[model samples]
Target chain A: MDPAKLLDILGNENRRKIIQLLANRPCYVSEISSRLGVGPKAIISHLGLLEQAGLIECSVDEQRRKYFNIANNMRLEVSVSPYSYTVTLHDVTFDRGKNEEDPVEKEIPPGEESSTLFLKLSSRLKELKKRQEELAQMQQQLQVEYTEAMDHCLDSIEEIARNPVECELLFELLKNETTLATLCYNLRLHPSIVNANLIGLTKRGFIEYGIKNNQYYWKIRETGVENE
Target chain B: MDPAKLLDILGNENRRKIIQLLANRPCYVSEISSRLGVGPKAIISHLGLLEQAGLIECSVDEQRRKYFNIANNMRLEVSVSPYSYTVTLHDVTFDRGKNEEDPVEKEIPPGEESSTLFLKLSSRLKELKKRQEELAQMQQQLQVEYTEAMDHCLDSIEEIARNPVECELLFELLKNETTLATLCYNLRLHPSIVNANLIGLTKRGFIEYGIKNNQYYWKIRETGVENE
Candidate 1:
C-alpha cells in the first residue's frame, strides 16, 4: 500500500534474485550473488522491497550483515494439486481420538460465504476421500506389480517391507527431517519408488508433502507407526 | 496493487460495512450488504481490493453474486490481537503436525512481495514440535486439574471419563473433518465450550487449530489418539 515501499521493493534486481534463490535455502547476500553471478548491491536493492513488503527476512549471525531467509511458513502450495491428509491427536487427560483435515469446504462467516466455505471444505474433503478409495483400489494393482517386482528382487514381502536401509530411512522420516532425495540416496532406492511409496501413503491419507529446498521432504505421518 | 481495485472494493459503504460483518461469516455481497442501510454498490467497491489481493473471491450462486470470504483467514491474521489458528495440519505422511499461526503475532503475506514459502513451513513444523512438547507438559497439568475437579464433582473416574458427548464429539472431529469448531457446532455445543475444550485438546497436543475464519478450526495432530 505504500508507494515508496513498493517502489523500493521492485527497484532492485538483486532482491528479486534473492527471492528466487532463497526459494531453496536461507542464504547470505554474498552467497546469493556469487551463486547468481551478480553484485551484492543488485541483490540488496531488490531485497529492500521484499523486506519492506515483509516477504523476506534476514537472520543476523552476530553481526550487522544480515543472513537473509524467507519470512516464515510460506510453503509453495501446488496451486491446484490434490493433497491427502491422515491425522491423529492425543491428549493424556482426554482419553479419545479425533479425525482431522477437511476436504470439502463449508460456510463460515457472514451468511453466504459460510455456505461457500462449507462447500469448499466439503469438496476438498470429498476429493481426498475419493482419492483414498482409489488408493485402496490401486493397492490391488500395486500388489500385482509388487509381486512381479518382488519376485525378481527381494525374496519376501517382509524383506522388501523391512529392508534395513528402508527401516533406517523410515526411522529418519519418523523424525520429520529427511527428504525423498535423502531417503533415496541413503537407502539406495530409485527416487521414483520412494516417491511411489510416499504417494501411496499419501493416497491412503497418511501424509502430505510441500516442496522444500527444491525437493520433496518426506516424513512419517503416524506417530503410532512402530518407530515412535 | 490497483487503486481502482481498492476504490472499487471499498467504494461502497455497504462493502466496507460487510468487511466488519465478515469477521463472523463468509458473506456474499448481498448478504454482506444486506445488513447495510446503504446500497449494494457500497459493499462491492470495498470488496474489489479484498478480492484482487486474493483476500476473498466471487462465485456464482443459484441467484445473485456470491463471494467467498477469505479475510478471516488472512486479513485478520495481520491484526495485533490474538488470531488463533483454527486448524492444525498433521501431515503424518511427513511426520509433521503444523499449526503455523503464532499465538502472539500473526503476520499476513505481503501482496506480490517475495513469498515466505520455506521459512514459514520449517518454522511452522518446528513450532508444532515445540508445541507438542509444551502440550505434553500441559496435559499433565490438565490431568491434575481434571482429577481435582472430578473429586469435587464425581466419585468414579470411569463415570466422569465416559463423557459421551465429549468423546463422540472427539470422534466426529476425527472421522470426516480436520477442524473442530464446525463439527462441535454441528454437535450443538456452545462455540465457547467447543473453543475451550479444543484449547485443552490443543494444549495436550492431541489437536491443533488451523486458522481459517477468525474462529479457530482444529485438526487432530497425532496418529492414534482417537483409537488409543
Candidate 2:
C-alpha cells in the first residue's frame, strides 16, 4: 500500500480512534459509534473507508448484526532525516499453515487451564517488548551516526565546490547515482547547464561518469580526490 | 509532538516533496517552487505549516534570500496489528557538544583531501544502512510473535468467557488495568452492567480487584484460573 495514501486515511482523529477501538475486538457499528461518542452515520462512513483500505473487515453475526474487526496485521514506518525520507510497510503474519509445531496453532485440550495459557502469552509479549525497545535504541544510535556522516560530507562538499550549482550537484549526487535526464528533472536545470557542471565536476575528479544500458550516469567517486 | 498531528501535516503530497527537496540542501522559496513544479504561493503555505510543526526552518542567506532546510531529524513509526495500534515519534540528535572526540566536529585543514572525507562518510553510512536493515528484520519477527500471542489470548478468552459481556470485559482488561468508571467509558456500557460483569468475573476468579487512592481497579489474575 502507498504510504502517502495510508497517511491521508489515518490523518483523521475519528478514524484513528475507530482503529484503536477495533484493535481490541470486533464490534458492531452501534458499539463503536456509542463508545466513541460519534454519530452512527459518521462512524459508518469511516468504517467504509477503513474497510476499503483493507485495514478492517466486516462479518455478520447470527443476529444479523455486522461486526467490524482489524483485517490486516501490518506496520507503517516513516523516517524523515536530513539526508533521507523513507516510508516502509511490513505485512506481519504468523503462518500457522507453514509451521505445524507452532504453539498457537495447536488446539487447546478440553479442560486445560486458561490461566496457564494467559501467563505464557503475557510473559512472551513482555519479553518481545523489552527486546524491541533495545533494538529501537540501537537504531537511534545508527541514526545519530548517519546524521554526522551526512553533515561531514556536506561540509566537505561545500569546501570543494567552486560555485552554488556545483555544490547543489554534489549534494544531489550524494543520494544516489542518476542519469543526466533525471538530474535535470530533479534539479530543474537546463540540460546544457547540468551537462557543463557534470563534465566540470568529473574533470576535477570530484565525481565520475559511466555508461550503463546505453545511458550515462554520474556518481561521486568512492576514493579520495585524485590530483593528476 | 502528537503523531496524528504530524501525520496530518505530512499527508499533503506537495509538503512531502518540499521536505524531500530540502533534505538534499537548503533552498530558497523560488528554488523549491520551481524544482517541485509547485507555485510559490502554495509552496509558501505548505512551508508555513511545516515550519509551524518544527519540521523545517528558514534562514536568510548572504544574498538576503530566505532559505529553508530540515529543522529536525526524527522518525515516526505506526504499528497496526490485530490487537494494537500505536504511533511513535523519535527525535534524532548527534550531540557533538558532549562528544569532543567526534570526527564530524573537527575542522578540516585547508588543502586537506576532500575525497578521503567523502569516502569515510560514505562507507560509514553504508555500514549503518546494513545494520539498520538487520534491526528492521528482527523487529518484524517480534511483531509476528506479538500477533500470535494476542490471537492465542483472544481464543482462550473466547473459550472461557461465559457470555459476550464477560468476553468483552476480558479483552478490554487485557490492554491495561482500569477502574470501573474508565471501563464503563471504554466499553460504553451502563454503569450497572459493567459493575455486575466485573463482580461476576471476579467471583469466577477470572480477574481480581483492589483499591488504591480510594478507587478500585480491576485486572486479570496472573495465575491460572482458580477452582474454589
Against the true structure, whose lDDT is highest?
2
Off by over 4 Å in 2: A93-110, A190-217, A222-228, B93-110, B162-166, B189-228
Error of 1 at A91 (Å): 30
Assess each prediction's global lDDT (C-alpha) against the native: 0.42, 0.80
Q: Write the per-residue lDDT of candidate 1 for residues A23-131, one digit (tens) a residue.
A: 4346788887787798878777766657766666777786766776655322111010011111112222332121112122112234324322322333343444355
Among incorrect, acceptable, medium and high, the docking class of model 1 is incorrect
lDDT tens readout by residue for model 1, B1-228: 332233233324444445544533356666656566656785676677567655455666677657655321211101000101111111111111122333322243332211222223323444544553453344344333332332221221122223655444444443344455466545567777767766665554455556766655666453323322
Docking class of 2: medium
Which candidate gets the maximum DockQ versus the true structure?
2
For residue B9, give model 1's deviation from the true position in Å. 24
**Lowest lDDT 10-residue stretch of candidate 1 chain A:** A77-86
True contacts kept of each: 0.00, 0.64
lDDT, candidate 2, B1-228, per-residue tens:
677778888777888888888887778999888887889999999999989988888999888989998886788878888788888888775464454576545665555566667656766666778897888888888888777777777777877788888888988887677899888877678999988988898887778887889988888776666573
- Clash total of candidate 1: 77
DockQ, computed on Cα atoms, for candidate 1:
0.02
Clashing pairs in 2: A115-B224, A224-B115
